[model samples]
Every structure is written in structure tokens, then in C-alpha cells.
Target: MTAQQPAGGAAIPQRPAVDFGRRYITFETPRFAGRTPRRTMIVCAALALVILGAGLASLTLGAYEVSFGAVIRAIFDPASDPDARQVVFEWRLPRVLFAVLCGAALALSGGIFQSLTRNPLGSPDIIGFGVGAQFGVTLVMIVLELNTYLWKASGALVGGLLTALLVYALASKGGTSAFRLIIVGIGVSAGLGALTSWILITVSVEKAMMAATWGAGSIASLGFDQLAPAALVFAVILVLTLPLTRRLPVLEMGDDAAAALGIDAGRTRFAAVVLGVALIALVTAAAGPISFIALAAPQISQRLTRSNSPMGTLPVMLTGAALVVVSDAVAQLATVPVGVVTVSVGGIYLAWLLAAQYARRA
Candidate 1:
């Protein structure tokens, strides 16, 4: 085709306008101009206070009604009072610690996925990985006849990894749209949820009851031995995840931009997904699929820090820990599962989020 001639008699070339629909949206790590470090310090300190207050409430407000000083004394000097030590150190302490650890893990996992997918709804629990892990645990307990903590953990890890791989593959086939990924993940989660229920129903009555209880997501009746391995795994994963997540805000700028910044967007995403899945699996294996903490914690942290980016990892972790500890304490009032409380609270928050989004659009 011949080029068109303009009024000046020179040939003019026409080019199509570039579309910036998805790639235009970019989020960077939260930064401050002058008082960055100070603000961060204050936020961190505030988050710590929240976590500490939750822990104190968990330790003090229970059936025994131990005082805060008594709880502290029992933790540091268990030999001073046998009854106090028994209540704080032996009975309640392990459960409380597990709740905190699991909550942190779930929140971190959620943060990683949300950053990777660049969607607020990209959470392990929401995307079916949590249910997948629960299915694995159920299978091990009922079908495989292995009820050990290690076996359950292995099952959960395998299940979660498989689900992640499946979801990523399906999403990438169409070039990895975040909305598509979430839709696919929801379908996968529904299937897995059905399977979990089927497994529960087919098992013997006692076994079914046991599976149901665990599936309800409780930190109750746990011992130090159960929490120890999970804690070690969480610490190792945290060490690995923290460094990798330094690239997350960059990744949020789209693959091309991220590559321009010398970040291997693909590799970083894979590592993040792996680490996030591992976190979810470990926590699910340790304390079942505690619902909504993963879905809610990152958003809460983001709002609390008033940052647009998902780089507030520590804040998210602390918020998550505080949430679960507080929820567990509330659950203690009715002696119900912490998962129940989280789901109820999360449902209300989810409703609010939807309403806010609609209002903004309007």
C-alpha cells in the first residue's frame, strides 16, 4: 500500500494507538519521601502492640481467668505456680501459639498471591488451595489410614502444590489474566470441597467425626509436639519467602515493566506461588483450613498502612497473627472452632468490600 500524502506533500505514516488497559495499572513498594523509616517503625510498633495485646487476651481470658501478670509469670517462671503453669504453659499456650503462627502463614500466603495475580481476591483460601490441602489431610486420615502429623503435612503439601500447578497452567494457557485465574480457582475449589465432603461421608462414623472436627479448623487440644514441626517449617519458609517477595511490587508493574527492571517476572512468580502454597499447606496441615484469615489479612494490612502496594509483608503477618489470636479467644467464649469465628467475621467484611466497590463504581 502506498503511504498517504499530507497537505505539505510529504508521505505520512499512520500508526495504531496502543492500548494500556491492563499494563497501565502499576503498584510500587510503599515509599515515603522524608519520614519513611520513622513511619515504618511506628507502624511496626503499632502492629506489635496489637499482636501483644491479642496474645495477652488469649492467655488471660479463658475458662480459668488467669490475670495478665499471672500469665506472664507462668510463662517465664513455670515452677512458681503449678496450676497457673498448667493453664498457661501446658493447656492454652500451645493452641494460642499455633493460632498465631498459622494466621501469619496464611496472611503471608495471601499477600504473595494477591501481589502475583494483581488482584485483591487472590488468596489461598479463596482460590481453593486451602480446601485442596484439607482434602489431602482428609484423604490421609480416612482413605490412607495415616493420622500422624507428618503424614498429614505431607498430604497437604502435595495437594496444595498440585492445585497451584493446575490453576497456574489453566490460567497461563489464556495468558494469565487475574480474573480468569480466580474464576478457575473457584471452580476447582468447589470440586475439591465436594470431594472432601464425599470422603467424610464415606468414612466410618468415628473417623468421619474426627475428620469433621479437624476440618472445622481448631487449634484446640494441640500439644507442643504438633506445633514444633510446623513452626520450624514456617520459619524456614519465611526466611526464603521474604527475600523473594522483594520483587513483588516490581512484578505488579506487569511482566514487561518488571523485565525492564531486571526482574525475572516468571521465575519470581513461580517462586512466590511455591512459597505461598507451602505456607498454606503447612498451616492447613497443622490446624486445618482456618478460613478467611488468608483472604482478609493482606487487605487489612494494606488499609492499616494506607499503602497501595502489597509490600507490607510484616504488617500483614502481624495483623494476621493478631486476628487469629483474637478470634481464637472469642471462640473460647463458646468453645467453638476459631475457623467458625473467622468465617463469620470474614463474611461480613466481604460484604462490606463488595458494597464499597459498587459504591465507588457508581
Candidate 2:
């Protein structure tokens, strides 16, 4: 590769193309430039298709038994079977859309933390953030007796941020390391779990039951009332997160190296933690603490794309959305909470991941 002489008679520096045995497409502009693996693009496309197919499949699974055609018509045709339209639009569509939003939000949060910690196990669910959010929402519902979306969202956001700060403070004792963070987080999560349990036991049976159901994490009862606000918050948090995507990978190179590159490691990490917690809070507020999608989605996407970079946010979110949509559909068939389905599947994934990590160490 060589610099090309332009019409102005000046040599325009060109980035030399390097082949690394894998095909990649490059793009450049005055404001931005990057290369993407072909495999990543394909995997992302496939995941998007999976989310679409699974979401459509989910729409037809309930007791009302809307046919595939009916589902499509309900969405597009105003005059198509008023009853079917009601079932799909008013009832089922919200749940399906919520599933996608929650899944994507969780996955993005997980990716942010994992990238920050540079460890596969660094997820909001594992770090007690989800538990903290659950605890907050529990207090609001059981003690404050406020069940509105705003109250729950506020509780979740505050609780998750507090928990994240505690974990970070504990882990940062001698400068935070991935292993220390995970260990401290696990301890915090366990203590919170015990406290939540104690609170449940002391509360009235009705309140306890309601808390337990929400804690188990189900989207069955959620409709537009919750979805609209959640979606709005998600959009805002996502915009804040976009700038971090590029900076996060730089921080992965370590604080000194990132500093040399003009990236503020401390500020970036703080923003990542806050935005990540907000993402978790958003999901926990509406759907309760749906677990494991955050833990598994990013890793699954990384493996599917075979990319080392944690910047592949879109594919990770799609993977999560697909996972939740499919799992929700399965939950409908079993008449169980979506959280139960994810926990069952995610537990297996966790086991496999731990085994792999152990084997590598051994």
C-alpha cells in the first residue's frame, strides 16, 4: 500500500491493508473509522433473525391461540379480527417487546461490566447489583406500599447504584482487580439475599407473596403501562453508553496505556458503572430481577462472533433478546415464570463456564 497523490498535489496518507487470515471490511470517514469482521456481521444478522422468529413464535403461544397469520395481521391490519388484535396488540405485544428490551438492556449492562473487569464472570447479576435492585423494589412494594412504575424504577436505580458503589469501594481497597471485585460482590450478594429473605418472612403473607412473585421475575402481567416508560429510560441510557463503547476497549489496555491514548480511565469506568447499573435498574424495575441473560448473553455473542473485542454491543444485545424471547415462549408452555426458565438454562451455562475456567487454570 502507498499514499496516493490527490488533486491538490498533496500526499494523502492511506492505512495499509493487512490480512490476518480472516476477512474484514473497513470503513473510514473524516469523523470515524473502523474494520469489522465478516463473521461478526453474519452472526449479528443471524441473531437478529433469531430474535424476530422467536418473538413471532412467542406471540402465538398463549391460550388464545392466535395463528401465525393472525399475529401478523393484528400488528399490521387494523380491521383484522378485533378480538385477535386485542389479544396480540393490547396483551401479548407488550410482553414480547418488554422481553426484547429487558434482554438487550441486561446484555449491554453485562458487557459493560465484563469489559471493565476484563473477566467473563463480571456481570451485574453476579456482582449483587441485581439483588440490590430487587431489595430496593421489594421495600417499595412491601413497606412503602407504592406499586407504581416510577416508584419501583426509583427504588431499583437507587439500590443498584448503592450496591455497585459498595462493591467497588470494597474491591478498590488496593486498586480494584477483577478477582477481588467478583469475590466481594459474591459476598455482598449473599448478605443481601439473606436480608431479603428475612424481610419476606417478617412481612404480611399477602405482601410477601407479591414480593416473591415479582422477585421470581415474570413479564406475564406487564403491559404498555410499564413498557412505555421503561423503553424511554432505556433509550436515554443507551445514548449515554455509545461514547463508552470505544473508550471501554481502550481502558482494557490498562489505566496508563489508556491515559496515553487520551482516554480518562477513571471517568470512563465511572460512567460505565453508572450506565450499566441504570440498565440493570431499568429491567429490574419493570420485570423484576430476571437473571442470567446478563451473565450469558455477551459471552455467547463473543463466542458466536469469535471476536476478542468487547465492543460488539449490538450482537450481544441481539443474542440476549433472542435468548429471552425463546425462554419466555418456553416458560409460557410450562406455565412458569420467565426467570425460572432463564435460571435453569443459565445455571447450566454457569457450570460449563466455571469448568472451562478451572480447566484452563489447571
Best candidate according to TM-score: 2
Residue ranges of candidate 2 with Cα displaced over 4 Å: 1-17, 26-35
TM-score for predicted model 2 compared with the true structure: 0.93
Instruction: Give the poorly placed runs of model 1, Cα more than 4 Å off.
Output: 1-36, 76-79
Q: What is model 2's C-alpha RMSD?
A: 3.7
Q: In lDDT terms, how accurate is model 2?
A: 0.91
Model 1: which residue pairs collide?
none
Worst 10 residues of 1 by lDDT: 20-29
Alpha-carbon TM-score of each model against the true structure:
0.87, 0.93
Q: Pairs clashing in candidate 2?
A: none
- Candidate 2 residues 1-362, lDDT tens each? 58899888989889977767788879999999998888888998898898889888888988898999999998899989999999988989899999999999999999999999998999988989999999889888888999988999999999999999999999999987999999999999999999899999998999999999999999999999888888988999989899988899889889999999999888998999999999998999899989999999999998899878555688988988999999999999999999999999999999999999999999
> How many clashing residue pairs appear in each of the predictions shown?
0, 0
What is candidate 1's lDDT per residue for 1-362, written digit by digit as tens?
44788888889777767763322223455683332434545666887887778777788867787998898888788467789889888888898788889888999998998888888778887788888788888888899999888999899989998988887787778477988999989999999999888877877899999888888898887889988888998989999997766699888888898899899877898889889989988888878889888888999888877767665678888889989988998998878999899999999987887688688879
